[model samples]
Target chain A: MLAWAIPTYTPAYPGYGASPALMLNVSVYVMLFMAILSLIRISVAVYTNRPVCSEEREFPEDLEGDDGFTQVGRMNLLHLARVMIPCVLLVVAIEYIGYALASFAFLMILQYLIGSRKWLQSTILSSVLVAVLYIVMRYGFGVPVPGPQVF
Target chain B: MEMIFAGLLDSISPASLMFLLVGVAVGVLIGAIPGINGPMAIALFIPITYYMTPLTAIGFLVGLNKGAFFGGAVSAVLLRTPGTPEAAATSWDGYPLTQQGKGEKALRMALYSSVAGDIISTFVLILIAAPLAAVALFMGPSEIFALISLALTVIAGIGTTSICRGLIAAGFGIAAGLIGTEPVTALPRMTFDVYQLGSGLSLIPVAIGLLAFSEILLQLERFTVKGDSEHSANVFSSKLEDRLVSFKEFFSKLKTLLRGSLIGIGVGAMPGLGAPVASFMSYDQAMKRSKNKNEFGKGSLEGIAASESANSSVVASSLIPLFVLGIPGNLAAAMLMGAFMIHGMQPGPLLFKENAQLMYGIYGSLVLASLFLLLIGRFGLRLFCKAVDIPAMVLYPIVIFTCIMGAYLGKSSMFDVGVMLTFGFIGYFMRKFDYSYVAFLIGFILAPEWERALQQVVIISENNTFMFFQRPVAMVLMAVTFFVIGRTFWVSINDSRRKKAEQAMSAEQAKNG
Candidate 1:
């Protein structure tokens, strides 16, 4: 994505330019300033052969080792990827399916990824939460909440 | 003698007395719940006040605020989970005391400290609100702009978990507030042409999304991964310290309590920076000046006293800016302002002159509310300590349900349901990915004010951009802001890194076990 700063360039504002111009000007300035500052600091550290902050060492590879769930570094990214890729992709594939159905699909995928077979409980809980969210903001506050309409 | 006699009669009429009792009862129950707080409880009742006398309505609001203040401390002390954000800081020391089997004693100190702070601040609110409002009448847009800038600076220093992340999060939050409409011309800035996008995001739904719903979602994931059930415990057995401390102990904390109260008052005076700042500042100041700083996180009784007193102290002081300057100091106060407008009373500079008796009613209510807080807090301490019995399993579903109901109750739209989930998703990702939710809130609150201020500044200067620096207050604020940001970043980075290191060590120990 193209990064930009957004300036409030109101037509009435005299000193302000076009909205896009101001945004580009600010973003470019900040991005360049930060990049140069970081480069200078990095060069100084490397050229001087000085101590630097090391991220990988401090991250503790065994974090969540005792945490009943999978550790971040050790999780089989391939297996996890195999499961998530299709489930996420399938969401858009079912174009005729309603929003509520899509929501159900999302819950099923999340539950399975987390290694839960307690389908009934997960379905009940997720459905109720979605329904309440549907009723409250949509009906009570005159706020338009999203849900399955075509189904 | 005449003033005391007359004031007592006027303050304690049958009608006022009835309202106070009802307010206290409602306060304790609402406070017992996790989401509804003292200020919010008052705000909810503000609209209903149209049906009652001013004295009764004010009495109810004040009494509720007082009761909720004490009620929140109870959950913090006994459950180790604070019912409100202010009480969250209290749990730093208060919860440890509970785990160490002194929950009852911690509850007592919290009640005593809360009562002491509320009474002192109520009196302070009475004497200061009108005079401050009068002074505020003379402030032009320039002064308001400076004041807003100073508030933003102060918020940066108010103990965020990380200064850089907090600042970035705050910037993002301001941007979020900018999304709905341009303040001057009502032109839509960022709405993608959807009719609903122009209305912007609703705060309550966003709060429900961030604080309530997403938290439940995360909690549910633990059930499968861990595959272990929790064992429930009894509520009010041995945790009570059984010793009603002597007046000597109370008197010993008097100075500390007063110091904490002043910190609370100062933080409360600034709108948009509410009780959390007051509590943190008071607790930090107390630790700095205390003889027992080493015992702060390890069930220190004095720490509990300082945090509770200062946190509740914000209730009245926060009202000062709201009434005097027509600026909301926090989300709860902003909601309260909306409710007041519903009651046909404009709470600003004109409030005192236009409605003196109503103002007096408010003052009387404040004093009465604090008094009732002490009475109910002392008696209801035992009952409140029982909430910890709820295991995470059953509570998550109920919380999720209530969050949905609260959103629906305010507006009966289904699309807002999707809005809630979307924000909930955003909130979860932000917090999970290291963004400050409170900074986002601050951005939302100050967006309109900044826009209006900038517009006025532009018009007044007639395009002389340099004129912004010419104002003395603005320049001083800007300078102080730079210094505050630098100092805040240094301390925040150190504190957070230390906490992370400590957590890492604890995880290693657990893994070994």
Candidate 2:
């Protein structure tokens, strides 16, 4: 988590006139309190032999027989990894390849991973969605979609 | 009076009216789809509204909120799934009604009650917002801090079954909010010297990550595990006349509708207590008073009316706090506040005084939205019902694309996208752990304001924080805060004890058998 932080600091901002450490101190105290409370909660859960987190066992009984997709199913670790890895890579790749190509690639890859039966249909849909979004952002809303600057 | 008339005309103008219709249509479509909610939709649309006039933008968003409330009920009735958390109570009677082939009746009841409740609450907001804002103007910084503290405590208590977990989430949220430069000194506190962190996390990224992206991740798990039961074919049979509800039958439950509206309006006006609480509470009350209580979880129209009315009414009445005190009552209102600030309008006492015309314009928009909700809902009910059949596999990937687009568009920074993804993971964990994300969100939204108010109090009292005790309003608010926390703790303890006892009894029964 600390790796996300920048290493250096400078007191260069214009408004740092009398330090308002009071608010900062209070916020830190609240965080400490929360940390302590979380410890206590875990301790209680262990002592009671109850699960620390509610187990996702099945869909709610009311939705038991529905034909439509249910959001809660068994945790698919492999499927999750397959989706998450590429998503993270896509975020990184966007900086180099730009949003248009990165988005199109991300969607196509994700659709295949999620088990899209028709590769041609997935490709066309991904292209159409990406084009529509790019046109709307670049032309309709005037937001600049990054082009291939590095590549 | 003249300004009010002008504002009314402005709201009803062709362009504004068109946006309102669009907002309602979009909101209803999104809301009918499971796992997508109003807050996520609103957050996603915030950037789009950057080019819109303030009145049209606000009118459109407000219409979206109103339409989503009723749209959620469509899935609850036909698909036995809640499109939003607030619609969970609707499923108690709604799904059963569908099984009994009265899905259309249930949907119509939900629609009428939602609109009736929403219109009444809008009237309440219009009538009370100005006077409330006037009263809020008199509060000192100390008084305001105490009031916020009380609101946080109440919210923490009512938001979750476990008050301790709720407070923990809120505390973490406050810490998260305080990560940027300190408000008074402008000195970096916990930014770790990151330039992006210096501005604090943008509300858009955090909101989208928590509400939208996290949901997609959670829903993705469904792909791997197939259900045991064979999928029931023809969830909604095409015999339309069998399900149509008559006006006379709906009118028979007018008393339940009014009761639910009152409960909704009351809960919505209070910060932290939101639509779910109001809907469940009203459902419980209606069940207790019902002549045919046995029919409650088995397709009672009155039960559907009770839950839908109460939840829908909250859409309008929750804006009361935001309009009067510049403090958002819930996540949806917080998003609305962001829209207001983006349009260069601050929401408090001065807003009513300086922007009376705009306030009246907003009120006019609400009235127009209610009428639009009725028309669109009546004509487009089948379309929304069909929306439920959309597969999660296709829908969620598209939603993810939108989420990313929204995060990037907010500040046009990749750092914001990273922030959104990180928070999405955090939100997923929070949900699994039974932590109240709503409390966390409210805490994050209020932290900056709370700190600023506390600083003002310290400066005004010359650093004598004890002076808070001397202020009658401040003292009263503090006392209320303490009382609420204490009561919540007591209730939580008793609940735990009861659960333990039940567990022990079940063990003994199994041994005897």
Candidate 3:
């Protein structure tokens, strides 16, 4: 970050009192200092509070529910993948299948994955929603939706 | 007075009224559903507002903001879950009231209290905003820089558990803001030769990504992992009298209502303290002052009044700084600032001089929104309560689609969509790490102005830092900034040490036992 903050263009404009990159440099450098301090603090705390060696060590129960840091600390990678993979695929699918078809599929898939166990109901809902959205946004509002590149 | 009347006429026009009504309805629907918030809704809808006139669009958003506060309390009273974070305090008494079969009465009280607080705050905003802007007009770049510095520090200190993490998030935000072009030289410094980044990251994509898209991802995780738990929304009381809040009953708690509104206004006027803090503080104060203290957690009307009023009042009072100094008081206000800019209006002291009628028009709409909230909350209460049963499966998918559409429609650029996706992940991680995304957002929004002010100060001072001393206001603001940072750090350190000592003693006690 410090190296990136170095001014690439040094020639000052007439009456310009400071380097153009002055604010940029200050922000980056201060952030670096704070980051280092935080790292040191974390290191010291961890060192001082070393875990006891035992065959049957009891882990503390995480009381902070879904609203807190427990979600991040013990991240379910598979769950994340399920959510993110579809999102990424939707972006790609939009280019290939157009916005309406892609959105319908994405919505149905996400709904099914998230617990709408009945596939037929999810499909009908997704289709009606996509059709209405496409008509409203494209016709009513005149906002363009992506069309299939291949078509 | 003439200008105020003209603004009122404009805001009451057919087009303005229609947009405002729709915005309020949409906002209420969004807020009544758990997992969506006012900021996220505003972010998602900003792209849609690209088609409307400036006054109409702003009035619509303001109405939306007002409606959401009241809407949040609906779920808090009906279900144990709060639709918004600020409503968490409301659920303490509100949910208990639901359990006791006075759910209708509790919801009514929450609505009445919310509207009452909103009207009072809107009135206060109208009374003070112009004068505050007039005073702000006298400040120079040095004072502005100092003021921004103070705001950034205070927000970082109060918006998070750790001031260090908040400031770090803000630092990264400022750095992100520097990526497009150098103001003085017109040279790109941090663009890394990306041609698309020459114009910098667009505000719509960033806002929608951070506030809306990231939220969708979080909700998705919660739903998929936790397995959607259905909340029972069975209203126990079917009696008409139990559902109604008489005027006498409302007036009986006037003291609590007034106290909560005042606390909300005071907190909301300050940047970063936000509605959650204000609502909790009001709840605590009400508990302390209440004669029947035991009723607080056991379905007290006063407790609901305190929490609802404080959170609702914050919706308008938080706009005080945004209107006067062009500094956003919270995340929603920051998004409003972006909306104002998109409509070709800057929201500083000059706003009064250049667009006084428009400002007054917004004020008129704000008052109108309170009335609309009352009407909607009275009639649409049952309909919106059903929003909680919409299921995470259905709602999350739709929200995700909206996020995609909002990001895509901003500039019709694929790169912006990619930026949205990237920032969504960044926001998710930031929230997980307990960083104050509010501080990050405020920092990002204010970075350009901060940079401009610094540049001006540097030129005026001829590279000498001592000029701040000659300016008393600037000097004082800078001093206060340092003082706040030092005080926050000191308090944080002391708190950690106390916690460590307590833990050690508990461990020793366990060993002895």
Candidate 4:
């Protein structure tokens, strides 16, 4: 079962100018084509008695149970939070504290979050890593490392 | 000839040599480590190249690319875990050899074959890319547009398990690619009044996000969901005979080596088929042709040669399209394209004419890199084996820091850092959904050129959408796109129906039992 359809895309700002958005229109057209193709794929999957694009095997016995799925989902979310929260904080730190101090703190925090329970060990390692990186990036390579804003 | 000599001289300069050596070492270390590969390393290091000379930077990256291929086989041989997908077939015979205490023999054969393949294919690149670029220079905009369309169709249809997902990923890429402004009119289209986005998203941020950051997230999830299963990389033999291959023994497999290189070049030149495919194909051919086929999975030197040679050769042959037509044949090549553009040189026919010296310099560096691979792989094998033992907990966090630094260095804008984070999440979801990120990236890389060619076609055709009929090449390419897409859909539908029938039959048989 195959089908083709074009979805109308209203521009975010319609009154920008008199010039046509030829590129955007073509992009939208391609996206619409993709949408139609996806719809067909979903429909065929359902009709064929397959799960909707599920990567799971057919045999229930071979599959991870609902509980397993929930546990995996929970673990993934936990892992993501562990990584992303520290990442966001690190970026915020870099904004206020400059590259050297921010990088040292960020690496220490990240190493801890990734399961380094030894604070002194992680701090020493992080400091050395940061110093090396700062020297290479700032002095050796001449790329501008971010400095704290005075304001 | 003088240009070639000058290029060779430049490649052999102290600074270039230093960077290339470092690139290869880092590449090998990364490739030997599980859950990291060449593309990630290249993406992370690209921003650092902002300060280096063009020849040095590119030579460094090329060395990285070459070293990673051989490095991947190290883990495959010693640990039974392929560090890169391209080395998946290597693990088959390599692990068996390890079990038989011939791991050193397997490693040496892999190194020799890899260098041989890389050197041969590098020569092939020198022989072909210029003439092909000259031919590509004559292509009209309409034909170019049609060719890009055909390339995208093939990549979307063949690159992923699901054609719909691949095409949708490409569509999303095109949408993202159109975010900044319309090229012809210079009118902002999807910027939503974010002045920072008046210029399109930077390549470094997006690439770092997609290739490096997302991979980190995936690795984190992998660790969380399934605890890391660490493999020890211990060679089973210390015998001199087992550690070294004689010249006569290496030369005995010349047929297998040459055949693998040829298969690699053929497959690697295509847009979607990549090193993994070439390696597996070469391995299968070697197995089929060998008189002692039964020995293949039980530690055959020919198997290692076939797999390693083909995968390593792909590093250079995959550059053929990128150098000749400005179309990257794979993800690594695409990243290289981004690097080229970052260095203020566009790849294509103009590169051959305008940067002939640079081109020859790059070729010289590639050959040099192969020799470096041989030297490094021979001497530093144990060091790289130890690299595989680096804990994920230590590695992932450090990778994140580098990614952040890489993103920030692109434009010195914290905004690009935000962009990188956003794309990181997008890349995570894209991977979860089995979309072809390769297709997405290629689409993104080619989007500007595609739009320009399309605009030219429109103006040349006077708004006639069917103007393809006037250009035979364009018409044929378009037809091929349609035909391939149609065939892919047809095959997919038939496969689904067959699976459904088989499932029903199996259920019936189970019920009867």
Candidate 5:
């Protein structure tokens, strides 16, 4: 009686078996379910609400988000490019310096980029922090911390 | 009592004090940074603490965890961007104050609240836990399970949103916990034979991806969006003295503070739920109980105070279950347990007998840590204020990089690092679409435990589904569960209607105007 019958198998790729659904009550209940539910609720609201059709209506200019909560401007193309290039390069270079070295360099640079004028203060604090971590890792945990080679 | 005095004396030593102060400072900084969190900070420090005496190491990590809770507020107040998920509630009201040229005052309130609440709760934790643990020594798994159920019930009551969504979130959390090797059976649930999946997803990477990397992606859309600080961010003279509210006005709000504290402790003591829930629940309660509900989200100091104190107090409350029952209240406490274990101290019933002095040391250290939090957060306010100045152009990449680095630290594997970044990008999309990143975090952190618990239940129940309903405690918990779900759905429905009405009224008014 059914003209359009569905196939049972979607077929699996090599090294795979009959694929279970992407959700198996396992993935659905943990976190993805909440997201799905919220998305549905919010989306229905957004879709059903009609535009007011008022020219003066706009997002409040004074609204804030917190790291400091003041309104932050969008980055110019140049500024965005400036950060993106170095970020990509840093990913490639991250392994060569070892974790501690990479952290020290990265944090110092970040402090500057964030407009910290207390270079000496940051350097001293960073040095102390790294030193404390170094001692802890080497002596406390006995991990052979990768110090810069003497050679 | 003898051991307690000795432990206090030991912790008061110069070495211990140094470790405690440094730990709190380190905790705040690590917690303040986007993506990094309390648990990961503790884990990272655990290895480094091996050489130190357990007193120093434990002292330091405890102080550090406490410190991180407050640190996130600095980033939350200035940027309107919470540095940690716990600070998200703080941002709702805290950020509004910043826009009103009251950033300094807002930050000060958060600082004082975090310190005061944390100190008060530590004393409460000490007084309550010792006696409770002693009493609970005779308890069996049946009682433990019941307690956990009650705790979860309390936690489930936190969110004011749709009850279905909250239950769905908790169910998802339970299901997420039900993965990997079954503890009772040692059989894999759905590992697919992968080595990494065998251990399951770690909380640190998940938090970094969800809170930090995801935020970076969201911010990327408006990477160039900049707003000047309020016309007078430097308008310091009158408000500098905290003249916005009279002293008589401040004393009158004590009732709200106490009520929020009660809600915070109740939500916090329950496992799985953590600071964010406590803060939000407290904030919600404050609004409901207030003579002026609209004052919330409108630069109300009481709103800020309630949320901030509730979150910080939850930190101490979280330790109650940890110290008494050996069940961690949340991810951060779980990692702290791991650190304690690595130090040759298993924190459970035996822990009280074998290491009573050490227990007292922890109690003493928590008090000291809260004191330091108050001292540092107040005096260091000006330094933290500068955080408000960082441009999104520079800050976003740094946050993203920190997340990547944090993920790499987890396994020292570039593979895991890539996994962190992948999740970060996905997490970004999740946030844009109003996804429950908190659910994801709960899932990742509790996956192994949830798996173990379900397997235990399945085996104990002999696959008899009715067993879950058979126990009186479980029955009560289930009843409460249903009530919560029904209430939440009802509220959400009402909320949607109310919002619709407001929008229609606004539209009509606009047309007339």
Candidate 6:
């Protein structure tokens, strides 16, 4: 399933003299080879009764319940959902709402989600940050902040 | 001598001096803030430097790099949070010193050592860059490819805990770099027909996402923990003078500083090994050689000196490869190269001959910047120390916003923002899996050069794949690469064996009990 998503050298543009995908092939093949090698090593280790995929040494006691090495603890999932979901949403939101508004929304929601109890304080700070960033990027630096064409 | 003097005068202009000071101040503030680093800071400021003179602009950036090195130590000491990865080793002893109410002393030691290291390494750069460039001028594409390959191997070996993971990360990075249109054919290889991907991923977004946004996510995880919020509030709340170190005390650690500076210079001159590696290596060396070995990781001043000096020295010496060969040693140097290109200055052997005055001026600026870093760092320590007290909730969100804005500012592309977010997720997973993101980043950065050189080599050899083996330098590098990979694997195997044996012995003891 994962391999399908990994881009391979397709030789798409045949008319262009030499294959332009040479280095691409080199990189993809090397990665695929390493992944296979790792899989084999792990299989051998498990089969030989000396499993090397254990997280025992990689993590400390405090992090023992969390994922390390090959361990897929619950915390990894929680963290992924907590962090990545918002980031992904922010990326999507920026295209629709614009950078300033999306950033303000993102910051406030992030703060709230992270357990910031001072809602008013978080709102003010997030608003101010968004405004300041908008001003600096849009006006001061002349870098266009993604917004309505009128702006 | 006359050109040196002229260059010195050129660098000391009021406008240049002002920019240098401003750069140091800005760099220190950014560096002292957790989740921000020199490369990100430089990337953010590169657009601003477009309007300034080359001398003033490069000087300001160099000063920023130097100041950030010391500034990173500030957060490491006072908050046990390294503002940059290079400061990770400093936090080992620095945080202990802070716990013992010697935070100011640690900061002062970091400042002095940073300045000393910067001075020595800047002088070393001045002395060796032209000569190295002269030597490098004679090298062919094959030789360059060999050198770059050696760099990749060394980075893969030293940058991660496992050789497999490191190589895997490098492969992925190279693959990522190969996305977009192939340089020679102008045909897209891995873009999957996405128009934005056809232009290739810009370095700014990828870097900002990897270093900054991933860090923001990590910090968010910490902030979610109930105890961590209260802990952040209380950080660096003690009286300032109680933690101060005297001049005599700082001078006592000169030997350690010198040793670290040498190590940093050596590592920095190498193409791929960076400040974080040098700092940790120096700290390890210091711990091994110390009479009071037990004092390490327990408020030892020597530990702070070792890490601070080595990391700071890397700032100046890392430029040697960049200036002489036009090949940046690290991300920060790559940004500086971008600045150079923006200013119409190409760095290489011909640059020394064609732009001697400018080169000398840059050398002068480096020395002046070191002085500025010391001055700004000494006075601004108290101000930056307060940055540790800022709530992560307030700080990180603003950083996240800035990161997004910075990415957009790079090429004014929403596509870059998406790239940044994607890499942020990738970086987060990479960290969790204990893969070396540094090696990955270096691989991505070097991939274009690698591809170019490889293509050149192929053409020169008339498609003979084995021709590289005939070239002495290429053969030597290939041999070294194999040796390094083999050694790393062997070490891992031995380590696992020892660990298993110990586990078995412990099990037996438990059984007996």
Instruction: Give the whole-model CA lDDT for all candidates, comma-separated.
Output: 0.62, 0.79, 0.82, 0.81, 0.62, 0.78
Which is the better candidate, 3 or 6, if ranked by DockQ?
Answer: 6
Candidate 5 — which residues are off by over 4 angstroms? A1-151, B13-15, B27-58, B72-113, B134-180, B184-189, B216-267, B270-311, B321-355, B387-402, B457-470, B501-513
Task: Quote model 4's TM-score.
Answer: 0.93
Winner by lDDT between candidate 6 and candidate 4: 4
lDDT of 5 by residue, B44-137 (tens): 4554465578888888988888888887886677666676778887878777787777777777778777876787788788889888788767
Model 2: what TM-score? 0.90
In the range B1-513, model 6's lDDT, one tens digit per residue, is: 777787788898998989998998888888988767898788667656766899888998888877787788888887788888899999998888777667777788888888998899999999999998888788787877887777777676544677788888887888787777777677666677688887788777887788778767766665664235423222343665555667776778888999999999999988778999899999999999988899999989899899989999999899998888777787788778767866877666767877787789889888988888888877778888777677876777677777777777777777888888889888877876768776777788778778888878877777787877778877887788788778878888888788778878998999999
| Fnat of candidates, each listed | 0.05, 0.32, 0.45, 0.36, 0.10, 0.49
After superposition, the stretches of candidate 1 with alpha carbons farther than 4 Å from their true spots are: A1-151, B1-69, B79-102, B156-161, B218-249, B270-303, B321-365, B486-513
Q: How close to the true structure is residue A44 of candidate 1, measured as C-alpha lDDT? A: 71
Q: What are the per-residue Cα lDDT tens digits for candidate 4 across A33-137?
A: 877877886677668756553334211222344321112256666778887887777777787888787788788878877777888878877887787777776
Model 6: CA > 4 A from native? A1-18, A53-76, A95-100, B1-16, B43-57, B96-100, B225-247, B271-273, B280-300, B326-331, B334-358
By lDDT, the best candidate is 3
In model 2, the Cα lDDT at residue B130 comes to 90
Residues A25-135, model 2: lDDT tens digits:
554566567568757876887787664433232334313332222243234446557767777887899888887789899999888877777888788878988889888
What are the per-residue Cα lDDT tens digits for candidate 1 across B214-281?
55444443343335344312233452234354577778888889998988888788765688778888
- Docking category of candidate 6: acceptable
Better of 1 and 3 by lDDT: 3
lDDT per residue (tens digit) for residues B98-142 in model 4: 887778788889999999999889999889988899998887888
CAPRI category for model 2: acceptable
Query: What TM-score number comes out for model 3?
Result: 0.94
**CA-based DockQ, model 2:** 0.29
Standalone chain B TM-score for every prediction? 0.75, 0.94, 0.97, 0.97, 0.73, 0.88
